[model samples]
Target: MPKRTATMLGCAVLLGMLMGESRAQTDDPSGSPGAGRATVWIEPSVSVGATLSSNGNASSSNGRSELMLDVTPALRAVLNTARVKGFVDYSLRAEYFLDGNSGNRLSNRLNASATVEAWDQRAFVDVSGSISDQSVSAFGPQNLTGLADVNRSETSSFRVSPYIRGTLGGLVDYQVRYALQTLNTDTSIRSDSTSQVLSARLGSRPVGQQLGWFFDASAQENDYVIGRDTRSDIARAGVIVSVSPQLNVTLSAGVETNDTITLQRESYNITGLGFDWRPSLQTSLSVSVEKRYFGTGYNASLEHRTGRTIWRYSASRSASDSPTQAGSVRLGTNYEIVDALFAQSIPDPILRAQAVLQFLANFNIPADAQNFQDFLSSSATLNQTQRLSVALNGIRGVITFNVSRGTTSRLDSLTTLGDDFDSNTEIDQQSWGVSYGHRLTPLTSFNAAYIDQKSSGSSGISSKRQSVSLGLSTRLAPRTSGSVQLQFGRFNNTAGSYNDAAISGRITHRF
Candidate 1:
């Protein structure tokens, strides 16, 4: 189907279904902050400052005296209704040369997310995207290390997913989902690509059942606009057995086939074992192990919550072609999860009652929003990823800590063409960070953080970096706020070392 037609058809179906259902408003905003009195809102801010570097531009062989002006203007908007939610965060930064004009430039960035519920809650649509200027990778661990170049790059990416799920005549449960994601870079357009996945599943009603049966099928296509294209098909049937109230085990078998860009088409049998355990309200563990054509792999996550603390951990190993986009396809015959865990949205019992039922109904939460924050640790690579994090909340202060580690042996075929990629791409990376936010008063706050990062590239050059930041923010008026921050970053390389320090501030007004 043509892209335009498919989108229109999906929108039409969603609208038609919503037209037939009664309108209702959900009470909670799901922790999303927004304006309460208006459907449309915008907040804008401006900042100007200076950055001093002992060795500017990260050049080690020779030192140069350079100081740059940082001028930034930013805006945020939120739109909320009974059945829809949307937001946009945007900023523009223009650097001026205090000593010279040769290296001054302007940068812009925007991030947005939106969701529309239709069909009386039976169908829904989700859209999200980001265009940002960053001197580091999107992945958390990789971001900790300083980039070889301090100049920020402009990267843009987006995803559109629509889904409909419910039961027919209250007997047969069914779900249909489709998604498309694409990413592009100003530095490497050849890495850009569009990925699409479509899927459907059917199962018997899951209410009050110890054992349930299900069947799932899906198809995925990855078209690298500048590199290669690939497609996949999957189909599977499985049974989930609830051995006890707190524990459940699932056993299943399926088939998967992949037609890759440079590799031969391959088909393989897939077998898997999955377990879900909820020892109590504060704890949950989920583990899945599967046998793949190349090897055996597993993905596991554990979460625990105490009065003032929440902890999360996840580990996964997957062997597949490098992925262009980061998201999940419907589960069918394939047992390998790829980067699905990072892209999915896990379900939360506190958010919706029926959400938990959806899990038992189909025995799979394909797009769970509650998945561990894997995106912070895992990149769009073929590798093993592991992450652990903890957040603590107190009466006057909050603290968050996380660690991420990952390793990969090869770069994606799309990245092989550029000499820069060959020179800077990493084979191993490990990073950790800790942040603290304290409320000095009801309307004012103080924040501080420290980050340490290290990485080694395939080219054999190793580097370590460390950074620390402190800031204070307070309300200036009824609809206004202001902040000032100071930061220091140091980079140590095999050949030499460099350091940077900066002071910046901003004031924002909301309306």
Candidate 2:
């Protein structure tokens, strides 16, 4: 670590400890009495580890063995109160190349979310930001997007949304929202963008066995710093019909207009139908379909909780400047969500253990995006993405399998999946992977995964890849743990084929 970084980090540790100690002696239940009105809590930890790599640079003929040392420190803070609840997770990683095939490298990642309440609680603000690096290949060690090529770049994004939602009276409810999103990159390999969205809705919420009507209007503008810009507007009116306690139907009609050529700057009519169904307390499903001048688009999501297994599924077709969220994608907090859900479903120890097993074994790469490998382009596109995933947990162990497929085209290529891909074109890709894990003993466990990915680029070339990994983890101490891992992969394309393998071990101590 740099001298300045070390000095600043030391100060942070001291401050956090002092604050924590002082607050513990304070009289207030919310915080330390003498700490005044500080609502933010911080926890930081440091970790150092060493690894032996068979191929550190992930090359073919030039593979070399070496010993690597790495230092990683992280900080996490949480805020929970009547008005706000959120957290920030940040980490700094520094790696040293002892064999010197590669130079020393250091990188950091930060993810944070903050929500604020205002206007006497009628209005609220949501803020999120991230800075991270990603490999060009969507499935690389750093590229979980699973949709790109073989390169690495740093991407950062920030978003701020503020909205007011409240009922005007028992007869009507209203909401107004505005959002600003900015994307930045440290390198010139990608472009920057700023997006603004403004929307409003006036509706009569469905209650009991009643009919409700709603009016909606929204506008969005996207500016690509190095490319063309887009402007879009939408207006709609809809009605909800409640057929029963477990079912509701919505019908809507609208007009859409945009100045972005990708979506055809033309004006189009929008017709849509959406439904929410809850047949039982254990299952829920929602689906929406719409017809527009550009094409047909749909979004659907289903979730079910059962005694032996948990399930989640979602599919969507829409327009997006980028397929992933916040320019980088990671699997959402699915495991944690499942844990929380099953926590309420039953108290059976077996089921609880199964849930825990599933969480530990099936932890996945964030699939918020299509796992796309495409370079970040400034152009917008109307594309389709489908994802299906399931996990089973039991005494046998935990196993998870899922596949994400995407068909992308430029705004102008919406008519068909393209045969040629370029910095400005379209492609089709299917990526899938599976992971399994089971505890071998009380304090040790083993896990393994296999992934097969295929993609058809605009260049009319196809590439396929397969990767496999196995690892074992165990607790080393009260605040320390260790793991050993082995990974192997094969890649074949028009260029040639290559195989690479690596094995490494690391121990992390938290303080």
**C-alpha root-mean-square deviation, each candidate:** 9.2, 6.9
lDDT of each: 0.59, 0.64
Tell how far residue 164 is off in model 2, in angstroms: 1.4
Off by over 4 Å in 1: 1-55, 61-82, 85-87, 94-97, 101-106, 118-122, 134-152, 319-324, 328-380, 411-415, 419-426, 440-445
Q: How many Å off is the CA of 123 in candidate 1?
A: 3.9
Top model number, lDDT: 2
lDDT of 2 by residue, 1-511 (tens): 1322332343344334433543443336766556444444555767776766555555455656656788889875555444654556677888787888666777777666656665587988766666676433322232111112235666666666779998886778899998767766655645567777889999986676468889999888877655566788999999998888898999999999886655447798999999999999779999999997668999999988777676778899887853222322222434443453566564543345344433453332221222234444445666788877776766746666777788876664433321132332656778887777777876678888888878666666667777788888777776566777777777766555556566666665546
Candidate 2 deviant stretches above 4 angstroms: 1-43, 64-67, 77-79, 135-150, 262-264, 322-375, 412-425
Candidate 1 lDDT, tens digit per residue, 236-312?
88888988889889888899887542366789898999999999977899999988654677899998777667777
